[model samples]
Target: MRRLMSIVAILAVCGVIVSSVSLQHHYATSKTEYCDLGETFNCDIVNRSEYSSILGIPVALIGMLGYAAVAGLATVYRERRDTPALLLGGALAGFAFALYLTYIEGRVLGAWCILCLSSLALITSITPLSFVVWVRSRD
Candidate 1:
């Protein structure tokens, strides 16, 4: 079970890394049509919106750091079982933030970024896996 959890965590980390990198690229280039699939789905519109940043820092960058921290904590969890609490907490926080971003994309921007949605999925998956890890660790 521990091995399985580690593998799941690693896969989640990779998924988040890929999504974060893609978002970062979108943020840097400001190429709206890069991931624009249609009128309702546009990466450029969402990434360039005012909600894309917080207090001067790009949200994508913050996501990258958060994912990286989760990865690091997962890696160390093998040595410290109690680390699952931190992992679960971090995953929950990321999940909440992702939900907020989704809301902003749907309600405010009226557009969707593929990369952001992908990150949301990754973090959403991580939350449950981390919860399981935390539960198993308590045993």
Candidate 2:
């Protein structure tokens, strides 16, 4: 369990970093060369779009908080029996939101953010690993 939680914590930290970059992009007044691909793959376009926020709050900020919660649960609360369930539940919710954002990028926005894709990958891995940890804890 410690090993699994360690991995989860590491991945969550990476997610935080990715989300921080996205948040920066969300507020950036100028285009960044690194994430500025062509039209179909422009981070600036996707990050600045109307869908980038919810109820006037930046989605990237929400993502940072979510990842931080997962990391905290994996590390600070790992000793608790309920931590596994909590990790699984949080992973599922993050995964679902990531999927929704992905759909918005591909379908509605017609643009993609590399940092967003990286975040999606991180959450995707975290979800399955969290499930495995939950299953093992159940046994």
Candidate 3:
């Protein structure tokens, strides 16, 4: 269980880093070479879009907070029996939100941000790992 939690913590940290990069992209004024991968996959278009923020707060910031919460649960609260459930629940919620953003990028924005996709992958991986941890803890 400890090893599994450690893995979750590491994945969450990666998520934070990815979200930080996306947040930076969200605020950048000028385009960068790495952010633009032609018209189909442009981080600038997705990051600068009106959908990037919610209630004046950047979504990337929310991702950072969410990942931090997961990390904290996996580390500080690992001894607690309820930590498994908490971690699983948090990962599930994060994954769902990431899916919604992916929908927006594909249907509304028509552009995909690599950072956002990276975050999604991180969260997707975390969700199943968390579920496995939770199940193992139950036995």
Candidate 4:
């Protein structure tokens, strides 16, 4: 179970990396052409919008750090089962943030960065998976 969670954490990190790339592209180009092309997943619009940068730091940077921490903690937890529920809580926390940003992108910015969407989906899935694992262990 720890191994599985660790793998999931790794995948989550990968999703975050993809999101960061898309965001960086938007920041560098400052255009919605490539990202907003599919209409379904418009990284361009989200990246150029006001919400791209939170306070002074870029949202993508935050995601990168967040995901990295998750992956690292998950790995540690995998090795040490005695550890508490920090990773579980962190996963939920990350999911909440991801959901919030995705909402802002889709509603306020009128765009849906594909990479970010994937990251959100990953977090959403992880929350449930982690919960199921935890619950099952209690039994």
Top lDDT hit = 2
Give per-model TM-scores: 0.88, 0.98, 0.97, 0.80
lDDT of each: 0.80, 0.96, 0.94, 0.71
Q: Indicate the residue-level lDDT of 47 in model 1.
A: 80
TM-score, candidate number 4: 0.80
Q: Give the TM-score of candidate 1.
A: 0.88
Root-mean-square deviation of Cα positions for candidate 4 versus the true structure, in angstroms: 2.6
lDDT of 3 by residue, 1-139 (tens): 8998999999999999999999988888889778699988999999999999999999999999999999999999999989999999999999999999999999999998899999999999999999999999999
lDDT of 4 by residue, 97-135 (tens): 988997797678776787777778777776776665566
How close is each model in CA RMSD to the real structure?
A: 1.9, 0.6, 0.8, 2.6
Cα distance off (Å), candidate 1, residue 61: 0.7
How many clashes (backbone atoms < 3 Å, residues ≥3 apart in a chain or on different chains) does model 1 have? 0
Number of colliding residue pairs in each model: 0, 0, 0, 0
Write the candidate numbers in order of decreasing TM-score: 2, 3, 1, 4
Give, for candidate 3, the lowest lDDT window spanning 10 residues. 26-35
TM-score quality measure for candidate 2: 0.98
